[model samples]
Target: MKIVKVFLVLSVLLSITGCSPLVNNNPTKVETSSNGSYKALLFVNGMELQSVGHTANESELVVGEFIGAVNEKVDIEIRPSDELTSNYLEEGTEIYSVEGNTKIVLAKKENGDYEVFE
Candidate 1:
């Protein structure tokens, strides 16, 4: 009986230790509006990250690849804007137009992560 009790206690302990807590690794997703002219994602440094429905300017930048299940190189563009549309939101993120600011960045990768620079 004692041996059976020990085994039961050991099994219970093992079960408790074997289960791992669910990990929450939800990354923040930033997206640009359908119209790039109206809404564009920008870095805190004022670099355009993603835009659509707009003419390409002379300046375009190739930034680091997006950190995700699939590694994809992201093209960050630089557009001229008169003033910032919003601030005091996410740090290290900015928008150029008063309409909206599309910004990118920030993630804690289990193995690797996307690196965004000024």
Candidate 2:
């Protein structure tokens, strides 16, 4: 019985380890926007892709900078509308406008598609 239990545990561990998480797992670097008012970060494969400005906004917001990965680049514009939340890749192009100041992250899947997190 003890051996069977150990085998089950081992099997579960192996399964979990083999499975990949949905987001990138790399370390990220941050850079402030050229205007010096906002910051942005770029993430690659679940890793900290890049860093940008503070995650705060007031009555108005504007597009800051563009987030890129390796050779790929995505437009990181600030939304004037407070309803914007985070950006995501819907069909082909990125859907920049979001709902609110929800923490947003970007990830590229194995299928070569972009995904946005909030």
Clash-forming residue pairs, model 1: 40-102, 41-102, 41-103, 42-102
Q: Which stretches of candidate 1 lie over 4 Å from their true place?
A: 22-115
Model 2 bad stretches (over 4 Å) = 22-24, 28-118
lDDT (tens digit, per residue) of candidate 2 on 7-76: 9999998888778563334323223356764333333334332323222142243332334333333344
TM-score leader: 1
> Per-residue lDDT for 1-118 in model 1, tens only?
9999999999998887677443222223333345552333333344433333222121232333332221222232223221221211123232222112124332222333322222
lDDT of each: 0.33, 0.38
Candidate 2 local lDDT, residue 96: 29
